[model samples]
Target chain A: MSITIYVPADAAALALGADAVAAAITREAARRGMDIRLVRNGSRGMFWLEPLVEVATARGRMAYGPVAAGDVCGLFDADFAGGGVHPLLLGFTEDLSWLRQQRRLACRRIGVIDPRSLADYKAHGGGEGLRRSRSLAPAEIVSAVTASGLRGRGGAAFPTGIKWKTVLDTAASQKYIVCNADEGDSGTFSDRLLMEGDPFQLLEGMAIAGLAVGATQGYIYVRSEYPHAIEALNRAIEGARDWLGNGPGKFTIEVRKGAGSYVCGEETAMLESIEGRRGIVRAKPPLPAISGLFGQPTVINNVITFASVPDIFAQGADIYSGMGCNRSRGTLPFQLAGNIRFGGLVEVPFGLKLRDLLYDFGGGSRSGRPLRAVQVGGPLGAYLPESQFNTVLDYEAFAAIGAGLGHGGIVAFDDTVDMAKQARYAMKFCAIESCGKCTPCRIGSTRGVEVIDRIGAGQAGQIALLRELCDTMTHGSLCAMGSMTPYPVLSALNHFPEDFA
Target chain B: MENLPAIERTIEAIVAAKQSLPGALLPILHEIQDGLGYIPSESVPRIAKALNLSRAEVHGVITYYQHFRQIPPGRHVLRVCCAEACQAVGGEALAEHARLRLQGSDLTLEPVYCLGLCACGPALQIDETTLHARVTPQKFDALVDALEVDP
Candidate 1:
C-alpha cells in the first residue's frame, strides 16, 4: 500500500513553502522507490508550524512541520520517509493543542476534507443544509435563519433573514442571490479560508439563499487575488453543479472571479464586476432588494453570512443562536493576526472580552513588546488604545467604544507603530483606491492625506485641518470610503496623539 | 461598454435598485456594484435608463461610496489587508512587496478593509486565498509561483 500525506494549502503553509516541501517529500519518497499519495489540505490554524504535513502510518495522520523545501534532506535522513518517527511528528493532527482549543462549528471539516470532493463533503456534513432545505418551505428556512440571530459577517451587523425577507417580499420576475466572497479586509481570512478550504459549504449556503428568495440564478463574487481559491471554487462549483440538474438543486450559484478592486467587496460594485465592467459603487434608492442583478430583486450576503446559514437550518436556529452574546448570537470566525502570538483562525462564541482574545487566545505580541494600539476592522477601522481593551466584540459593544466590529479581525502592536503615519496612510489608501466618483472621496481624500502629513510633520493648524477634513468627507461624501476614512485618522489622533510629531 | 450586454443589463438593474434603497450610501453602492461588477464610468446612462434619474444624481451617489470605482480594475485583483491587526508585524512591508511584485504585471494591489480574519496577521489575498499569519515575500512568491491566468 502506498503512503498518504496531506499538506495544508493555507496561505501560511504556502508562505512557508509547503508546496515546495510537499514536492520535496514526493521526490524523496520516489527516490527511495516508494509510492506516496500527496494531498494538499486546508490549514488547521497552528500556523506556527506551517508547511505542516501529515503522513499516514498505522497510527494516524502524523504531523511534521514548519518544514521547508530545503528540509527534505534532513527529513529523509532522519528516517522520516519509511514512517520513521521524528520530533516534528505530532500524532493525530486533530488533537493538536491549538486546534483542539477551538470550538470549530462552521469550520468542522475545513482543513480535513478535500475541498472539491462532494462525496467527501457529504460524508463530512457538506450538503446537509441543502438536503435540509429541500425538505423545508422557503418561509420556514427564512424564519429559522431569523431565529438564529445570524448577522452579516462582512462588517455590517445586518440580520441575514431580514435581507432574505426583503427580497422574498419584493415583486420581481427575476431575483438573484449574490454571495459576497470578497474578503477584502486585512487580518480577516475567514471568508477566504472558507472559500478555499470548504468551498462546498459556501456553495450550500448560497443555494439556500437562492431557494429562500425564489432566485434561479446566483453569483459568488470573489476577489481576484486568490487564484488558488478561484481554482478550488470553480472546481467545487462544477462538482456541486451536477447535483442541481435533476429536477431542482435549490439554486445554481455561479462563482464569478473579481479582478481585485477593494471596492468589489462592496456588493453593488461586486454586481458591477460580475456584469463585466469597472468596479465602482452605485447610489441606492431601489436597494438590491427591489432592483438588483439583471434589474430584478437580489439578495446579497457575505460568504460567512451564507456559510453560517447552513448551520442555522441544519442545527436549528436556537441551537446555533444559543452560543453567542445577546444580539450577536452564535459563534463567529475571527482572524487573530499581525504582530501577535498565537495567530490563526479562531471560531469563538460571541461576547468574549477583547482582552481574552488578545492575551488568552492570541497570547500577545509575537514581537515580545508591550501591547500598544489595536486597529479593528480594515483600513477604515479605528485604532483603539489599551483603555478599550475590555470592549466586547459584539456590534453594539464596539459602537459604544467608538469602534466598529467591522469584520472580526484583531491586529496587535507593541508600543512601536506610528499612528500618525497610519492615519496618513489611510487617506493615501483612499486616494489610490478611490473610484473618483465623488469630490469628497476623490479630492477630500487627497486633502486628508496632505492634512495628516502636515500633522505628522508637527506643522501648525494640524488639528483644525484634520477636523475640517473629517467633517468635509463625512458630511459631503456619499459612501463610507470618504465618510469612514476618518475613523482611522480620528482614532489615531485620539489614541496616539504623541505619535504626531 | 455596450459590447458587454450582460454588463449593460446589470447596470440597468443597479439604477433600478437605487430608487428604492434605504438611502444608505453603502447598501446602495453595494447593490449597484453587485449589478455591474465594477461601476462603469459611463454607468450614468444605464442608471438613468433604469432609475429615471439624472446622470449627475447617479454619478453623485457613486462618488459618495468608497467601495465604488469609476475606472476599471485589472483582470486579476490582488488585495492586501492593512488593518491594525496586520500592521503589528510587517504587514506594511508585505504590502510594499506585493506592490513591487505586481508592478510590471497586470495585477492591481490595493489595501482592503477588515476581511474578518483578524487573528491572522499580515494577510494577503490573491483573489480568494486569505493567507493567514507569517506572510513574507518568500511565502508570497511560492503562492504565486504556480499562478496562471484564469480561463
Candidate 2:
C-alpha cells in the first residue's frame, strides 16, 4: 500500500520553505523506491512549526515539523514514513497543545484535508449547511443565523442576522452578496487561510447566504496580495459549478481582485472599487443593506463571517451561541502575529482573556524580552499596555475599554518597541490608505504625522495639539479609517507615556 | 513602442472579453497590467471608450491603486512588508537592506503593507510569486544575490 504524506501549501508554510521540504521529500522517496502519495494541505495555523509534514500511519496522522530540505534524508533514515521515532516526530497531529486547546469552529477543516480536492471537502461535512439552507425558507435561514449570534467577524461587530434580515426585508430586483475578502489588515490572515484551505466551505457559506438574502449573484472582493487564495477560490468555483447552480434559484459567484488600496477594504469603498472607481468612501445614509454594490441592496460580509455560516447551520445555532459570552457570541479566529512566539491562528470562544491568548497560546514574545504592549485588532485598534492584558477578548469589553476587537488580530510588541513611533505609524498608515473623500482623514493624517514628528523632535506643547487633532479626527472623520486612528495614538500616549515624553 | 499595435490589440481583446461583465473596469485593468506588466497610459483611452467611462475616470482609477503602475517596473519586483506586524520583527531593517541592495540593480523594491505572513514575518515577495518569511538582513542579501545570478 502507498503511504500518504501531507505538506502544507499554505502561503505561510510556503514562505517558510515548505516547497523545498516537499521537493526534498519527493526526491528522497523516489531514490529509496518508496511509493508515496503526497498531498499539499492547508496550514494547521501553528506557523512557528511550519513546513509541518504529516504521514498517515496505522495509528493516525503522525506529525513532523519545522522540517527543512536538509532534514529530509535524516527523517527517511529514521523511518519517518512508517511513523518511526525521530527527533522531529511530534506523535499525532491532533495531540499538539496548539491544535488541541481551543474551539476551532470556522477553521476546523484547515490543514486537515487536501485543499484542492472537492471530494475530500464533501466527505468532511462540507455541503451540509447549504443543503440545510436549501430545505428551509429564506426567513427561516435568516432566523437560524440570527439565533447563532454570529456578528460580522470583520472588525465591525454588527449582527450578521440583522444585516441578512435587512437585505431580505428590502425589496430589490437585483440584490448582491459581496464577501469582503479584501482582508488588508496587517496582523490578520484568517480570511486568506479560510479561502485557501477550504474554498468549498466559503462557496457553501456564500450559497447559503444567497438563499437567505434572495441574492442571485455573489462577488468575493479578494486582495491581490493573496495570489494563492485567488487561485484556490477560482479552482473551487470551477469544480463546484454543478453544485453552485444548474437549476431553479440559480446563484453565481465571481472573484474580483483589489488593487493595492487599503481603503477599499471599507464596504462602500470596496463597492466603488468593484465598480472600477478610485475607491472613495461613500457617506452612510442609504446604508449598504439598503443601497450597495451598484446601488442595489447588498449583503456585504467578511470572509470569516461567511465561513462561520456553514458550521452554524451544520451544528445547531444554539450550540454556537451558547459557546460565547455577552453580546459577542460564537468563535473568533484570533491571529497572533509580530514578535510573539508560536504566532498563528487561535479560534476560541469570545470570552478568552487577552493575556491568556498572548502567554498561553502565543508563549509570549519571540524576542525573549518582556512584552511591553500588545496591539489587538488591526492598526486602527488600541495598543494595550500590560495593565490591560487581562482584558477579555469580547467586543463590548474591548469597546468599553476604548479599544476594539477589529478582525481579532493580536500583534505583540516586545520591550524594544517605541510606542510613540507605533502611534505615528498608525497615523501614517491612515494617511496613505485613506480615500481622501473626507478632510479629517486625508488632511488630518498628514498633520498627524507632522505633529508626531514634532513631538519626537522634543517640541514642547505639541502633545496637547496632537491630542486635540486626534479628537477632531475621531469625531469629524467619515469612517473608521479616520475615526479609529486615535485608538492607537491615544492608547500609546496613555499606556506608554514615557515613550511619548 | 515598436509593438504598439500588438499592445492595442491585446488591450482591445481584454476589454471586449470582460466589458460585458458587471463593473468590468478593474478586471480589464488587471488583465492589461498582468499581460503587459504595467498599464500603458495610451490604453486608458481605449478602455475608457469600451467601458463608456471618461478617460479622466480611467486614469484616476489606474493611478489610485498602488498595484497599477503607470511606468514599467524593473526586471523583478520585490515587495517588502512594512506594516506594524512586520515592523515589530525587524521588517523596517529588512526594507532598509532591500533598498540599499536594489539601488542600482534591475530589481524594483516597493513597500507592501502585509503579505498575510504576519505570523512568520518580516516577509517579502519577489515578482509577486515567491514569498519569503522570517527574512533577516543576511537572508535578504542572499535572496537578492540569487536573483541577480539567475537573471
Candidate 3:
C-alpha cells in the first residue's frame, strides 16, 4: 500500500518554502525506494505551521510543520511516512486549537482536498449545491439564497438575494455574472485563498447564480498579483466544462486579469476596466443591477460572496442563517495578519468579539510588545484603539462604532507603530490610487499629506484644517475611495491624539 | 533601438491574439508586459489602432495603471509590499533596505500595496513569479545575492 503525504501548494505556503520541503520529501522517498503519493493540497489557513506536511495514518492526518528541507532527512530516519513521532509533529491536523474552534462553512474544502482534482472535490460534497439548484426553478433558487441571508462579502454587505432578485426581475436578453476577485484590500486574502483552494465551489456558485438570475455568461475579474489563483481557476473551468456549459442553461465562465489598480476593486471601476477603460468609478443612480457590464443586468459579487452560495444550496438555508447574529448571517472568513502571532484564516459566526480574535487566536503581537492598534476591514477601515478591542465582529457592531468589518481582515500593529504616520499613509495611498475622476479623492488626498506633514511639524492650526478636509472628502467624494479615506485618518486622530502631538 | 521591429511584431501579435477579448485592452497590455518587460511607448499607437480606440484613451489607460510601465525595467523586478499589513511588521524598513541596496543595480524596485501574505509579512515578490514572506534585511540580501549570482 502506498502512503499518502500532503504538502500545501498555497501561495503563502510556497512563499515559505513548501516547494523545497516537498522536493526533499520526494527525493528521500525515491532514495529509500518507498512508495509515496505526495499531494500538493491547498493551505489549511494555519500559516505559522506552513509547509505543514501531513501523512494519512490509521488514525487521521498526522501533521508536522514549519518544516524545512534539512528536516526531511531526519523525518525519513524517523519513518515519518508511517506517522512516526518527530519533534516538529503537531499531532492531528484537526485537533489544533486554532482550527478546531471556528466554524468553516464556506471554507470547509480549502486545505482538505487536492485543489486540482475534480474527483476529490466532488467526493467531498462539492457539486451538491449546483445539483440541488439544477432541479429548482430560477425564482426558487433565488428564494433559497435570500432565505440563507448571505450578504456580499466584498465589504459593501449588500444582500446577495436582493441583488439577484433585481437582476432576475430586470428584463435583459443578455445578463452577466461578474465575480469580483480583484481583492486589493491590504489585509485581505480570503478571496485569493478560496479561488486557489476550492475553485470548483466558486464556479458552482457562479453557475447556480446564472441559473437563478438568467445569466449565461460569467466573468471572474482577478487581480494580476494572484497568478496562482488565476491558474487554478482556469484549470478548474477547463476540468468542469462537462458540468458547466453543456447543460440547458449553458453557463460559461472566463477569467479576466486586472491591472495594478486598487480602484478597480470597486464594481463600477471593475466594469469599466473589463471594458478596457481606466478604472474610474461611475455615479450609482443606475445601480449595477439595472445597467451593468455592456449595458445589461449583471450580478457582480466578490469571490467569497459567490463562494458562499454553493453551501447555501447544498445544506438548507436555515443551517447557514442559524449560525450568524442579526442581519449578518453565515460565517465570515476572518484573516489575522500583520504583526500578530499565529496569523491565519478564521471563519466564524459574525458576532465573535474583536479582542478574542486578536489575543486568543492571534496570540498577540509577534514582537511581544503591547499591541497598540488594530486595523480591521482594509486600508479604508478605521485604525481601532485598544479601548475599542471589546467590540464584536458583526457588521452592525462595527458600523455602530463607526468602523466596518470590511472583508474581515484584521491587521495588528504593536506599540512601536506611529499612528500619525499610519494616518498620513492612508492619505498618501488614496493620492496614489484614486481614479482622478473625483476631486475630493484626487486633490484632497494630496492636500491631506501636506496637512499631516504640517501637523507633524507642530503646525497647531493644521489639525483643524485636516479635520475639515476629511469632512469634505467624506461627503463630497464620488466613491468609497474618497469617502472612506476619512475612516482611518479620523479614527487615528480621534483615538491616538498623543501621536499627533 | 535595434530590436524595434521585433518589439513591434511582438506587440502586433499580442494585440491580434487578444483584441477580440472583452475589455481586451487590459489583457493585451498584460501580455505585452509579460512578453516584453514594459509596454513600449511606440507600441501604444499600434495598440490604439488595433483596438479601434483613440491614442489618448489607450495612453490614459497605459499610464493609469502602475503595472503598465512605459519604459523597459531593469534585469529583474522586485516588488516590496508597502501596505498597512506589511508595514505593521517592519515592511517599511525592508523596503528602505531594498531601495538602498538596489540604488544603482540592474534591479527595478517598486512598491506594491499588498501581496496577500499579510499574516506572514513583510512580503515581497521577485519578477512577479516568486513571492517571499517574513523577509528581513538579512534574508532580503541573501535572496538578492542568489538572484545576482544566477542572473
| Candidate 2 per-residue lDDT over residues A119-144, each given as its tens digit | 99989998888877788899999999
Question: Any runs in candidate 1 off by more than 4 Å, and if so which?
Answer: A33-35, A56-60, A73-84, B1-87, B91-151
| Per-residue lDDT of model 3, residues B82-120, tens digit only | 999999999999999999999899889999988899999
- The residue-by-residue lDDT of candidate 1 on A306-357, one tens digit each, is 8887777777788667778768887787777777887877888888888888
Q: Which candidate comes out best when scored by DockQ?
A: 2
Candidate number of the best lDDT: 3
Prediction 1 TM-score vs. true: 0.81
Provide interface RMSD per model, one decimal: 7.5, 0.6, 0.7
Question: How closely does chain A match the true chain A in each prediction, as TM-score?
Answer: 0.95, 0.99, 0.99
True-vs-predicted CA distance for residue A409, candidate 3, Å = 0.4
Residue-wise lDDT of candidate 3 within A1-501, one digit each (tens)? 999999999999999999999999999999999999999999999889998999999999999998999999999898889999899999998898888999998898998999998999999999999988898999999999999899999999999999999999999999999999999998889988888889999999999999999999999999888889999999999999998888666899999998889999999999999999999999997989999998899999999999889888888898778988888888999999999988999999988899999999999999999999999999999999999999988999999999999999999999999999999999999999999998999999999999999999999789999999999999999999999999999999999999999
Instruction: Choose 1 or 2, whichever is better by DockQ.
Output: 2
lDDT winner between candidates 1 and 2 = 2
Looking at model 2, how many pairs of residues clash?
A: 0
